[model samples]
Target: MSTVKKTVEVDVPVHTAYNQWTQFESFPKFMDGVEEVTQLDDRHNHWTTKIGGVQREFDTEIVDQLPDERITWRTVSGDTKQRGSVRFERVDDTHTRVELVMDVETSGPVEKVGDLIGSIDRRVKGDMERFKKYIEEHGTESGAWRGRIKPGDTSGPAL
Candidate 1:
């Protein structure tokens, strides 16, 4: 598995940054190669992405989440195998640092080559930068789900 970690500082409060991140369906607005994201529920979503001419669809489940702190997820069933988390930290009253860490396992030769060339790392970094710009421009989140979902909880988030 190849691991990529990236961080970006946004000109928003930790609440704003974390709230925007929770709106998973809006990811495509800033995430390169992401075509669509469907939030199936509070804890699950489906993603469609095309990178390097390869198209993939996947479903991910949020295993852990805490408002204004962190959100973690892993692929439940999909064309890819990966898990990741995003953390939000307050820099002050109006600034926040967003950190992302992901572990991905290359499936085929093309993906393996891309990983070796640091393409995955670059992509993730670019995504973070874009997100910074996006949130800064919007000045607020499009929507928010402040529910908390602890690992192993199947009932749902505590809204």
Candidate 2:
């Protein structure tokens, strides 16, 4: 596994930033490689993405989440293996520093080369910057999910 971490300061309150981040289904608007994201339930999501010219699908389970603080998730079963977390830090009432850390394993030689060249990290950081712009301009999230998920509850699908 290889890890990449990036941080960006957004001109928004911690709550605003955290709330926007929780709107996973809106990711396609700012995330370049994400084709679609469906919130299967409070703690589960289905992701369709194209990376390095490869189309990949995955179902992710939210491992942990704390309101206005952080969210961590891992792929339950997928074509690619990845686990990551996004954290929000309050710099002031209207300023927030967002940080993202991802651990990923490449599936092939092409992807390995792209990762080594820092393309993946660059893409992720760029996506976050776009998200900042979108949120600052809109002043709110497209949608939000304030639901909490317990560590071991797995049953029906409800977004």
Candidate 3:
């Protein structure tokens, strides 16, 4: 597995950023390579993406979530193997820092070579940067799912 971490500072409040992040279905609008994301349930989602000329589909289960804090997930079945988390930190009333970390495994030799060359890191960073631009330019969330995932509950995080 390979890990990548990226962080961005957004000109929005923690709550606003956190709320916007919860709206997973809106990802395709700004997230590069994410063809679609469907919120199957509060804790499950279907994702369609194209990376490095390869199209892949996956169902992800939320492993942990805490409002205005963090969201973690793992792919249950898919063309790729990965686990990751997005964390939100309040820098001030109108500033937030978003950090994302992922552990990924490529499916084949070609994909592995691409990954080793830093394609995945660059792509993830680009996605986060685009997300920052999307939210800041809009000045509000496209939609929100204001739910909380408490510690020790283990039923996946709330969105």
Candidate 4:
């Protein structure tokens, strides 16, 4: 498994950052490999992504979520094996620090080389930076779903 961790500070409140994060369908605007994301429901999403010339689609389930704090997801069906979480922390009245942690595994020689050279790390950092610019520039989220997902709950408020 290859792990990547990245953090970025955005000139927005924690709620703003967290709200933007919940707009999964807008992820492609700032997420490097993401091609598209469709929120199937409050706790489910379908993702289309291209990485290293390979395109893949997957279904992800939100396992846990906390408003203005964090969101965790895992692939329930997909061409890839991965799971991750996004966390939001309040820095002040107008600043928030967002953190991402992902665990991914890739098979094949090309993927192995890329992982060894830390390409995934670079990708994550780049994504984080883009998110910072996007949120700071917009000053608000495109949309928001402030639903709550408890630790053992698999469903959230309708989106």
The Cα local distance difference test for each model comes to 0.95, 0.86, 0.88, 0.90
lDDT of 4 by residue, 1-159 (tens): 988999999999999999999899999999998999999988889999988998889999988888999999889997678899999999999999999999988767777898999998999999999999999999999988898887676444433
Question: How many steric clashes between backbone atoms does each model show?
Answer: 0, 0, 0, 0
- Among the numbered candidates, top TM-score falls to 1
Off by over 4 Å in 4: 155-159
What does the lDDT read for residue 85 in candidate 2? 93
Please write out the lDDT profile of model 1 over residues 20-85, one tens digit for every residue: 999999999999899999999998999999999999999999999999999999999987999999
Query: Once all C-alphas are superposed, what RMSD does model 3 give against the true structure?
Result: 1.8
Q: How many backbone clashes does candidate 3 have?
A: 0
Predicted candidate 3 versus true structure: per-residue lDDT over 1-159, tens digit per residue: 899999999999998898999999999988878999999988889999986678999999887788889998889997789999999999999999999999998888877998989988998899899989999998888777767766457665554
TM-score of model 3 vs. true structure: 0.93
The worst-scoring run of ten residues by lDDT in candidate 2 lies at 150-159
Candidate 1 RMSD to the correct structure = 0.6
Which residue pairs clash in candidate 1? Answer: none
Q: CA RMSD for every model?
A: 0.6, 2.3, 1.8, 1.6
**Between the candidate structures 3 and 4, which one is better when assessed by lDDT?**
4
TM-score for candidate 4, residues paired by index: 0.94
